[model samples]
Target: MLPNVTVNPAAEKFMRRMVRFSGHGDGAGFRLTVSAGGCSGYSAEFTVEGAPLAGDEVLAVGDLKVFLPAESRLMLDGVTIDFSDTPTASGLTFFNPNAGACGCSSSSGTSAQPPGVAKVDISSIRRN
Candidate 1:
């Protein structure tokens, strides 16, 4: 597993509540990775998996397990996953210290745009 990645307690609580009903025969946690998509050249990907894959590094904090693939280790270091009940939006959010510039669409329906880092600071939104 990666030695420097961290899982905040707020994120752990959110994960526990979100996955409590998931019928995973084995333990269940999320896998984080980077893929070529979004407005930026790379985008962060997250999926709930039954267990860590062959090359996955499992970051176990509290009862939460976040599986970070070996390929994403460098880009995801010092990243923090958190939950907030902000007035505009609320859910699991990723704040990556390694990201240079990124942005995500805040629009709805077909008018949505790809994610890219922008200077806009929406008080109710979170960025990666």
Candidate 2:
């Protein structure tokens, strides 16, 4: 069991929309993982999958789907996903409760992830 994080209204609505809009016919939706890196050491990872492994949690919101990998779930059991649109384009933001004691830092100091969830693709795709 992982620590639970509070979900903001904006994040809940955005997550529901993203899952509904993903257009993936496959049963799987989003896979949340944790990986090494970040100033604190570990971060969370999110991905789309066709299926979820045992121990994974399937969360649904308004036809939207989000999956938490078994191992990753330990670190992000109760986190919330939020959406924000500033002068910049709209994007997903994570509000993780298991961040470092001091607090995880994003480029904008808005999003955060927990320790050890194997953030495979996200880190490679985006250079921090």
Candidate 3:
């Protein structure tokens, strides 16, 4: 059974390091949310979470906890969050199987469907 959203070992390790450096106690975790903006038509935002939200689905990877809202579950299903520490770039990158034309990160999971492709009003999607 695949999880709604999964975290890689590297991400968990990175989160551990972040908690140690941030001076937050063991209760520190991450909040995952989707907003309408990124080039892919949606954006993924991560914030520090002191506690779980009222109705979020929490995924525990190692000792780290990731909070995902109910609305974001479908878009994030089967997604894997990984961390990298290369000298040039160091951050968490999301690997979404449903991704399309992703410049950075997305929650829609794909490029905005063309006007003719679907009835979707691409213009209605605001830009950031």
Candidate 4:
């Protein structure tokens, strides 16, 4: 089954741009793979591909297509995807309302990241 994922305007725009500039023709799409990781509870990597890979499912966001593997589909359920660009960090961020509070030391009350939100820095993601 498809996950109930929400793509905010910024993320949608980013994905659209990725596919548009992929130079892979009309079927190109943004492939996103996410998993549980670190204090924020999520780690992600993305790339523009000509088509969905084996075992990947296509998720339609307006006219744009997002290719999600099985693990990503499970992780993204009821999650909101957003993009942020700032002096400190810039990239896709995931907000899962059902996520639990992080146990990391930085999350001991005065954390930069709020509970249940994972910031996937573009610099940290390997584009493949």
Candidate 5:
């Protein structure tokens, strides 16, 4: 079974802008992928692509293109990508509902084996 996914209005608007900006010259759509590396043993990756592969989540946001791999769709359910500009820097942020408790902490069960059954010492993590 797969959870629900909702695209935030802000992200949608940003995506639209990216489409317009890229479509004019020499750009394409955004490719969304889930790769191994995050605290949960996997992290999401985004790239620009001129086309989409088979079984991809092809969402046309204005002139921008959005592509999500079939395998990544389940984990990305109810995810929203937003863009923000701060005094430090500007970038796209991701919101995923499936993330386990701990918020990408190394001590969290997300990155542990057995899939959420293992226990971790929070105190130890804080000490480090």
Candidate 6:
């Protein structure tokens, strides 16, 4: 089953731009791959693709199409995806209410993430 993922306005806008400039033509969509790792328990990478790959499910957000792999579908269940463009960091941020605080710490001995928030840095969109 497809996960109940929520894409906030910022994220949707970002995705739309990616698909528009992907140079893949009309049917192109944004492909997102997420995994369990990082201090906040999530890491992600995205690219533009003409269609969904094997085992990938296409998530339709209005006219936008998001190709999500199986692992990403599972991980994004009940999660909210948002885009952040601040002076310090600019990327997609995932917020999972069911997630707990990560036990990992940085050199300062403090957690890198607060709790239930995972930030994925998409410094640039790589063409595939």
Q: How many backbone overlaps does candidate 2 show? A: 8
lDDT for every model? 0.57, 0.52, 0.56, 0.87, 0.53, 0.87
Clashing pairs in 1: 102-116, 102-117, 103-115, 103-116, 103-117
RMSD of each: 7.5, 6.2, 9.2, 1.9, 10.2, 2.0
- Residues 30-97 of candidate 3 have per-residue lDDT tens digits of 66666445454445656666777888777776667766777666556666667655544456655665
Kindly list the per-residue Cα lDDT of model 5 for residues 2-105, writing each as its tens digit: 33545556666655555455543444666666544545444655555667777776765555567778776766566655555556444455555455644544
The all-Cα superposition gives candidate 6 an RMSD in Å to the true structure of 2.0
Clashing pairs in 2: 5-78, 11-82, 33-117, 34-117, 34-118, 35-117, 35-118, 35-119
TM-score of each: 0.60, 0.54, 0.61, 0.91, 0.56, 0.92
Off by over 4 Å in 4: 107-111, 124-128
- Superposed by TM-score, candidate 1 places the C-alpha of residue 85 at a distance from the truth, in angstroms, of 3.1
For candidate 5, the lDDT comes to 0.53
How do the residues 34-76 of candidate 1 rate in per-residue lDDT, one tens digit apiece? 5444444346556667888888887777667777787677655
Model 1 regions more than 4 Å off: 1-3, 35-42, 97-128
Q: Count of backbone clashes for each model?
A: 5, 8, 0, 0, 2, 0
**For model 5, how many clashes?**
2
RMSD in Å for model 1: 7.5
Clashing pairs in 5: 5-78, 19-64
The lowest-lDDT stretch of 10 consecutive residues in candidate 6 is 105-114
Off by over 4 Å in 6: 107-112
Give the TM-score ranking, best first. Answer: 6, 4, 3, 1, 5, 2
